[model samples]
Every structure is written in structure tokens, then in C-alpha cells.
Target chain A: MSVTTRRRFAAVALASVAVLAVTTACGDDGDEGGSDGGQITLTVDVFGEQGFGYEKLYEQYMKDHPNIKIEERGKGMGLGDYNTRLTQWMASGAGAGDIVALEEGTIVQFKAQKQNFVNLADHGAASLESNFLPWKWNDGKAGDQILGLGTDVGSMAICYRKDLFEKAGLPTEREAVAAQWPTWDAFIETGKKFQAKSGKVKFVDAATNTFNSILMQTAGNGTGYTYYDKSDQFVLSSNPDVKSAWDLTVKAIEAKLSAGLQTFSDPWATGFKQDQFAIVTCPAWMTGVIKGNAGDAAAGKWDIAKAPGNGGNWGGSFLSVPKQSKHPKEAAELAKFLTTPEAQLEAFKALGNLPSSPKALEDPTLLASKNDYFSNAPAGEIFGAGAKDFKPVYLGPKNQAVRDAVENALRSIEQGQRKPAEAWDDALKAGEAASK
Target chain B: MTTNTADRTRRGRPAHHAQPPRPRKARGNFGTRLDLKTSPYLYVAPFFVIFLIFQLYPLVYTFWVSLHNQPLGGEGEFVGADNFTALMKDEQFWNSVYNTLGIFVVSTIPQLLIGLYLANALNRKLRGRGFFRMTMAVPIITSTAAVAIIFGQLYNRDFGLANWVLGWFGVESIDWRATKWASWIAISTMVDWRWTGYNTLIYLASMQSIPKDLYESAALDGASARRQFWQITVPMLRPTIIFTVIISTIGGLQLFAEPLMFSSGSGNYTGGTLRQYQTVTMYLFENMFTRFNLGYAATVAWALFLLIVIVAFINYLLTRRIGSAK
Candidate 1:
């Protein structure tokens, strides 16, 4: 209320405003791809509960390239949310990082806009053909351009809790458990046997995870594709692979063998801790997800078994350079370096992401790798032995959307909202609608 | 000191000599006239400029986008109202509209009634009145996302407090996200928890401004407290009630966060397995982000805007007659 006090307050307010303006002005300069003291910052966009496990690699790369600094985005982020954000950035032609990780299911969607990406083959990637598995290297191509480089492949397995197995009076050893079900039909019978003794706990975490595994395995061996063919036609209604997978999943649901949790959802994570389910159809990458969700409390109770079917994959990603990147050449170099056999092995050790490189798969360290979290199960040989021979399946441009549709239909059946026959009809209709 | 005051008062008797002299009028006339004309406009210019850039530009651009075959990467060929025509027959679009209206009715009616009752209780003299009023605002200030997350945990299927409490009542555990009615009730509880306090504050502010003489004369006429409230307070607060009704109408129809966070996982824009509680905003986001149909999403946005306007207008008309029973 006094003149001096008012003057002092006015001066303080002006000073604070001035400070805010200066900081914000500097922030704009720092963020708008500006160089600071000749250093180039390359942002790499990745997605998952844990990213592609490249922290140590980035630090090593920065040490080698003194002028370059590496930053990562989308660690601890879900794939659905990450893909949505990546679509926005690509659509805007700005805000995309120098390098982006494209999952196998989503890469086809981005492949349509091949002009937005820098072809890796043009950046001396053609000579590195022998570094990756043949099918993985081929999956990265759109026409004549190499759109992405192989990072990791998801070798399928069934991760089960040993403590729960003991409780259910089922075989607790990985090999014995795997031998109990050589086919998905046998797998369902074993599930019923476990359900009879387990009392409260069910056999699997969710039907969707099992459904995806069955679909991918069935498609890989039979049609070499699931919802779409090599010609990129929508084949959801006609594909025998889709129907077989659905029928097998419906059988499991009818038996009441599933815990009825949505995969990667909060309840599913809690299901792991609460011991609500005994098994989940886990690919190599999912081991890391299990450890994260199950937490340290569930340290040695889980083990990995060979998946109940022929060799197949569930999740994997590739690294690529966006054409809009300021440092596309450096980004291409980084992408190439990160997919090397050595780098792939590092990621495998950091997270349980099985490498897509045959050389990495053959390494003694990878072949003999025993994960303590899985009660020292042969995590390596189980996922690695068939890694090279696993068939590759072609996913469509709208595969992610259609897969979500099918998954939703499966969940609806598990929730008892729709019957198995009605849900299949819904899945076909939703998949058709989603493909548009 | 008395003599000094007396001398100052004597000097202040002649106001013209005591005050500072005015500047020359003729020389400053043109400058004064220019300031009078331009200064007022300058003071109000910033708001209009911001509104034009942020509001008007998006409104027009959305309409333009709705007419095109826009994909995620960029604009596609203009197809001229094809998106709107498709939306008319789309079952999913209508499903989302049904959900938004269902949630709005379930949440808003109870919220306003409880808010009015709370306002009336607080308007009276009570012990610890300040503490009670302050606590009423605590839910309002808490972020909606945080509230939804906590409530989401409480409603978790296997181990949530809600299910545990249900067990005590000899009832079966409910999967809140599985059914339409269950998801609606769960989301409605979240909406009411967050916004009831806000409505209470608004109602209480207006209640304090009502003239006291009407209540006093009503009591003098041997009217009971309940009768006084119905006869005097309700009629006088018509405009305030209408204002709250219209505001709630706009907010309720545009519901986004609570339902989106209700399922508590990735890709929850679908709201549930069967899209049980997907609001119009969630559908718009799902079309844009999940389905990558930008033109369709733009059409959905425009349609949602029109819906809110229509619903709010209906609310205005209905509430205008609330106190006309006399």
C-alpha cells in the first residue's frame, strides 16, 4: 500500500517477467535443431516398456564421434501410443527424430510413404546383406529401397511360473512342459488338466496373446501371411490361418482356461503378481516385459518353455532414417552401427530382445545364455535354435489396426459379451472396416 | 498540531488554488482525441487476435479437412462431404454418441442436485464452516488424470477396492469395463467426484448474492424454512441455475479424459472391448491416431461440435422454464 513497497513489487514483477522471456527465448534456440559449439544432436525415437536397449551403445557412439550427441525418446512407452505419435510426426514432416524404430507390423504402413524415408541401401547398406537373416533383410525393402535395418526378432516361447506349475501338479521342467504339448490342441488339453488342479489360477494370462502366437505360427507355415497376402490384399475373411487361430483360441475360451486379462494392461500386470494365470505366450522381447511387470518380487519363479507349435515370431523392430532428419547421413550411420552383430548381442544382454542377425544367434554367449529371472532356464537355446529357420509372415499396411480389431473381438468373447461364433463374425467385420 | 491542521483546512477551502493547475487545452486537444479513439481498441485487440488465430483458424481448417480424403502423411484429394455421408451410416459413430449422452445424463443430474444441496447446507451458520467449504474444493483442484488413475485402481477387476467392498455385500465381482451399464456407472462416478465440488462453489457464490429481505418476509408470513426455500430461493436463482445447466451441458457432451483413462491401458480410445464407453472425442482420436483416417476424424470433430451446440441449446430452453411453476 505504501509507495516504496508498491515500487519494489512492480520492479520484482518486471524482473521475473524479463527472466522468463530470456529463458524461453534461449529454450527455443536450443530445441529447434540448433547446433551448440559444433556438436550435432541426433534424436532416436524408439518404443516399448524398455526401448531397444541402446543406452550403453549411445554412450559408446558419442565417445567415438566427439561431435555427435545421442538422445532417445519413447522408453517405457506402449507400442500403440508410440505408433500414434510417430504417425503424427511423419504426417507433419517435422518433429520426427533423426532415427526411428519401426515394428514389423507397422513398418508396412510407413512403407507406403517411402519418400519420407532415406533408403539405407543408398548409404552403403547394400554391402551388409550377410549381416542380417535373409528374411529380415528382405522385410526392410520397399521396391528397390532399403527402408530399415534388422534390429531384433521375436522368437516365440511360453513363459510360465514354476511355483504355479508345482501347485497345479503339472510338470515344472521346461522340456517336460514343452513336450506335454507339441501342438496347440495338446496345449489346450494340458490347460484343462492344469485348471482341474490349480483351483483359482487359470492356465494362460489372456487369449489374445495365445491367439496372436497361434495366428503367426499357423500363417508362417501355411500361407506365409495372416490377414494380408504378399500382394497386399485384405484376406481376413478368406485366410485359413485366421480361422484356425480363431478356432483354437475359441476352444481355449470355451474351456474357461484363460484368466481374461487384456495384454499389456494394468490388470494383466497385476495378474502376474497375484499369480492369477500360469502361462503367457511370450516372445523373446516379452521376457523383459514380464520382468518389469512382475517386478523383483517374482525373481526366480518364472521359466521359459518352447512354444507349442512350429517356429514363429510375434514382435520385432527395425531402425531407419527419416528423410526430414537434419543429420540423415549420421543417422544412417547410427542405424547401421546399431544393427551390427555386436550391437544386437548387446541389446540381447541388456533386454531379452533376441537378435535378428544370424551371426549374433550363433555366438556362444547367446547360445549358452541363461536368464536368472527364468530360474536359469536355457533362454538362449530355446529361442535361438529355430531362430534362423523361423518362417517370415507378411503383414499388411493396416495390419496393426486389423490385429487390434481381432484382439478386441477375442477379449469380448473372454468377457462373455459375445459368443465364440458371434465374435468371429464381429472380428471379420471389424477387420474389414479397420483395413479401410 | 491543531493550529497546523486548522491552517491546512483554511487553505483547502479554495480547491482551485490547492490543486495543481491544468495543462493548456488547445495544444493537447488533437492528441487527447486520438488517445480516446485508439487506446480502447488497442486494449481489446490482443484477445481478438488470439481468438482469430487459435479458434477461428482451426474451426475453418477442420471444415476444409472434412471434405478431403486426408490421410496421416498429408492432405489427399478433396471428396466433398463424402466423409459426412459415411459418418451418417457408421454404427461406431452413433455408438459413441449414445455413450456420450448416456454418461452425461447419469453424471450431470446427480452432480447438480448434490451441488445445490451442499451449497444450501454451507450457506447456513455452522461449526468449522471454513474447513468444510475448503475441503469441498479439494476434489476440484486435484487433476482429472490423477483422480481417474486412482479411481481406476479402485475399480480394478481382480483386486480393486470396489470389488472388495462388493464382496462384503454378498455380491459377485463386477468387471467394470466389460458391460455398457457397468462402465457407464464407473465413469459417471469419476466425473461426479471431480466436478461436484466445482458446481457447489458456483452455486454457493450466487446463493450468497440473493437478497435477504425475501426470506425474512417469507418467515414473517409463517412460512416454514422448506417452503421459504422453494418459494423464494428457487425462483430468484433461475438465471444461475440456467447458467450451470448450460455449462454442464457443454462439458458433459465433450467428455474425454475420464473415460479414456477409465480402462487404464494403451489404445483405450476404444473405451472397452465393445467400445462400451467411448465418447465422441475418443472416437475422433481413434479415427485420427489408430485408424489413420484424418478426413473422417475431422468430420467427427465437426459433428461433435454441432452436437454440443444442439444439446446446449436444448438445455437452455428447458432450464428457462424451471422456476415458472407459479
Candidate 2:
């Protein structure tokens, strides 16, 4: 080949590769929606064990709206990873799905950046307020702008191993177990008694998880807020409910009832298989996680009982449409559909995520439903009852960070690395630092 | 820059001299001259273009964002130097720095020593030397997540191979994630497992290049194998040793994965219950991902970059003194 020809060919190859790279990096555009052959794809971002249990709903929605295709992402993903990615996408003004699921803790953080979301109140959501629980509907709103529609409510319960409870000479039936612990003090006494008879099996999975459940329950019933008040003040040091919950958790740790495992960790998962801990703080959403982690062998060995204190929420999520979505109208419609009373009942059957809708909670089908995994403990009725009594709690923008600080402090005590007093002081300081 | 010029000169002669027998059809043509000047740049443009877009842009942008109070999904206020000033006094930031250095020292020292000994042993005539050399690469080829997961199991508090072995010696099982030193040591071992073989291979390759006659003459002069290893092999592999040392310094100071995976649990960016083994990079991620403090995370990133540069420079100085001490 001629030198010029060879050089030209080489230059052309390099230029093409560069062009290919630039083109590939840009990838597909999000703007293409419902234009080509009247078909469009809607991406839904969700997290946790089974991703909102929306498979049947998605299939039904697509069959109804033939022009729209529904695709869900983030199945089997942890909330932490999902939130981190969602935060990046929100900040960058792109890359987020058309409809994104936000956990209760996450929604509080996103409430500070409410402009990124398409206010659902503008899209007929305000008219549908009576369809949901009062607090559930209000929690979706920032002032008058509604950012999301409530999907599920993580009502509190206590799931204990029936075999272990029987071995420990405690009541194995759900109603009898509920009668054993009517208050936090009674719960601790039960834990101590269980510990005395149960060898190599602790009362609870981790002090931190149980502490958070108690804190949520206490803060919900008493103050109706957590680390922050309605005005978003840092109240960790001043909140009487927080200190009482802390003291109650400290009492459990002092009684040596904790298994010293971090929830959702690998060791914690292993603990389920080996029956290392007799009980775990079970929110309505956690039943799915427990079923998956405990495997088929532990079926019928677990049962859900009433939580010791008043109803509180530890999790649950909202569905929001980002402003960056190319088809916010369609996204809002889909989100609204997924959160309807009928759709929520379908999800309740698929996963134990309790319906946030008051009508759905009162549905005869939902009330009759049983979780075969939990020994047919009337999972629907139990979670439904808890949801009815749960009061909404206000969380601040920096709630997760501050909560992490408290969880770390609790883990420190669980590891036997810090005194309760020292840990409490550090938790306050760390929480303050984290909020900054 | 000088090497590029020298390389052009050296490469320029081969084409010119080798092509002298052929007719120079476009020797004096303008297009040919322009092609000669620009085509070389075109060939190398992709690397520089990629570097500019990915590496240099992010670096400059990081410094710019470090000055602001940037949260996710919001415009940042330019509070110049406030982030840096706060970072200077921040105990968690300082703790991360201290942990980074502690892990770097604890891992790199034993890593290099073991690497040297392994390289020295592999340099000798042994059966199945090719197999042994290839075996050293297995850990490097293994996915980081797989390595982290396996090591996570090994260091687990309740049931782990490490604590199980310790039990044979009548020692109590250690909660690897509890204390600062225990977590650091566990993470350091993970680092060593992955990188020691890499350093060993580098040393082995460099050692093979050294003249074998020096070792033969040393043997004739009544020098033992240990003495020859220290005096002869050590001095000859100074540049390679320094190279490995500098590389390890950079890797160690920016430690993230080992410490991160070592602390299991959802949202576990703190490294431990008390930030015991939280390195600078992990702290950066905690700020960026967990806390959503974009400005603070950028500041942490810049600090980590400066730290790696400073530590790598110090490594250069210390490793340069190795053979010269003779």
C-alpha cells in the first residue's frame, strides 16, 4: 500500500474507534417514548428481596395498556446500594428510571430535594387521598406538593422460632406468645427467661435491630417523631423517647440476650440457618427476607406474634416519578395503578409487604390470606392490625446518617467494646457530626 | 516527554533507513510532510483523549467541587476553603488517615519481604518452575468480590478457618471486626494475599534479567546463598524493588475493598462499628454515597490523592536508600 493510503487507513480506523467509543458511551436516549408504533418502555427501579412483588401487577398493567411496556430493575438489591445509585441519578438529572421506589428513610432524605420529583398531586393523586390511610397519604406530601404514592407499610411484629420457643419452655402459639410480652419490660423478662433455658440460642439476632424497632415504636406512640421533630431539629440528646428506647435496649444487652449479629449481614444470614438466635425484629417487609434466608428447612418453625409495644414502622417504601423522566404522565399513571387498593392486595399475597391503603387492609381476601412460610400465622391480619394502629413519624434529611451513628454505637456495645454510657455519649456526638 | 521524543527518533530511523531502497515518491510533497507530522499524533490521540476526558477532567472537577457545599440534587454554594478547614479538624477524617497508614505499613512490609523471598526461591532451578510461575497469577486473576467474600468467611467472628486454627493452639476466637488492630490485621492479610504474588512475579521477572555470572563468581568466592541473596540479588533488583514499593504504597494508602467487604452488613461504609479500619477511600464513599455530602466527598477524594502522592514520594526516598546503604 502507498504510504499516504496506509496512513489514511490508520487514521480512519483510529477516528472510527473514537467515534464508536463516544457513540457507545452516550448509548440510547431516554426521550424515545410512545412515538414508534405506539410502543414505549417504562423502567421501574425498586430494591430489596423481591422488588415490591409487582410481577403480576406489571403483567396485568401491560396487558391493559398495550402501548406501554413495563420493565423493573433492582431485584435482589440492598436498599443502601439502590439509594446510593438513585441519589447519584437524581443529582445528575438523568439515569434514574421513570418510576423509582423510595424507602421511608430515603423519602425523608429526598424530601429536601423535592424539586427533582414530579409532584403526584398535580396528576390526580390529591383526589385519591381517601383511598390511602390518612398518615400514608400525608407522608407522601411536602407541604402541598405530593412527591410519591404510598405502596406498603412496614408494620412491626416479632417473629420467633416455634421450635426454639417450645424448647425454651415458652409459649409456641402466636396468641399465647403475644400475651407474654405486653410491654417492653415484659419483653425483656421473656427474653431473659428464654435465655436461661435456651442453650447456645440468643433471644434476638442483634441488639441494634431490636433497639431500632423499639425506638421506632416508642417514638411513634409517644413523640410521633424520631431523631428529628416536625421542624427538623436534632433531638437525639433531648428526645425522652429515644433515651428510654436506648435504656430498654441497653437492658436487653445487659441481660446477655443479644446474638451480636448485624442485620442483613452474611453472619446474620448464617445465624438463621443454624438457629443461632431465637427471635428477630420483624417488620411487615422482613417476613420476605426471613423466608428467603431461612430456606425451606425452617418452614412452619417460625411464627409472627404481636410486637411488645404500640404499632410502629421500620420500613416500607413509596413510588415516585422523577422530573427527568421523559414520560412523567405515563410514569405517574403507572405508579398510581401499582398503589391502588386492588394492586396492593395482589402484592400482599405475593410478598408480606402490608398494604398502606385502608381499604386494602380491610379487604376480606387480605384478611383471609395466610403465609404458609410463617406456619399460616394469619400474616395478613397481623400486619393489617399493626398498620391500622401505626402513627406516622417525622424523619429529617440526615436521618439515615444519624441512625447509622446510633446503630454503630449499639454494635460497639454488642461487640463488648464500649460501656453503655460511653457509647451513648459517642452516639450523640457522632450523630451530630453525621448530620453536618 | 523525553522518552517520546527519543522513541520517535529511534522509530523514525527504521522507516527512513529501511525505506531508502524504495523510490521516494512523496519525499518533498506538502501532504506527505503534514501526514508525517500529524499521523503520529493521530495514532496516539486516543490515549491522551481518554486520559483527558476521564482522569484529568474528574481530577480538576473534584478540586472545584471540594470548595463548595454540594449536596445531591441541589446547586452548591461556594464556601471557599470551609470544607478543607473542617476536614483538618474532623476526627473521623483523621481516623481514616491513621487507619490507612496503619494498614499500609502492616501489609506492605511483610508483603515485600515475602515477595522477595518467593522471587529468590523461584529464580533458582526447580522442577515445574513454569507451573509455579503461572500459579502465582491465580489470585490476581480471581475476581475481587470472590476474594473478598472468601476472606470475609475466613475472618468471620463466630465460625472461620482463621479462628478455628487458633483454637488448636488453645487461643480464644477473635472478633475480627471489633477492635481497630484486629480489623486492620484482617484487612491487611486480604491485601497481602492478592498483591504479594503480583510483587513476587515482578521481582522474579526483574531478577531473571540480572547477569547470572555475578552469582557464579560469588559462589566461587565462598559466599553462601543467603549472603548472595542479600548482597548480590538485593543490589541488582533495586529498581524493581523501588517500583514495587511505590506501587504498593499507592495501593495501600487508597485501601477500600478489603476493609469495606470485611465489615459485612447493608450500608456498611463505616468499616467497623467504631470506624476502626475505615481508610480514606471508604470514608470518601461514606460521604458520597451514604451521607450524600458531595462536596465533603470531593474534599476527601482530593485529600486521598494528596496522601497517595506524598506516601508514594516517601516510598521512593526510602526504597532508593536500599542498595545505596552499601
Candidate number achieving the greatest TM-score relative to the actual structure: 2
Worst 10 residues of 2 chain A by lDDT: A25-34
lDDT of 1 by residue, A156-205 (tens): 98999999999989999989999999999999999999999999999999
After superposition, candidate 2 runs with Cα above 4 Å error: A1-37, B1-28
TM-score per prediction, in order, is: 0.92, 0.92
lDDT tens string, model 1, B36-100? 99999999999999999999999999999999988877548899989999999999999999999
Question: What interface RMSD does every candidate have?
Answer: 1.5, 1.1
The true-versus-predicted C-alpha distance at residue A380 of model 1, in Å, is 2.1
- Classified by CAPRI criteria, candidate 1 counts as acceptable
lDDT of 1 at A320: 89
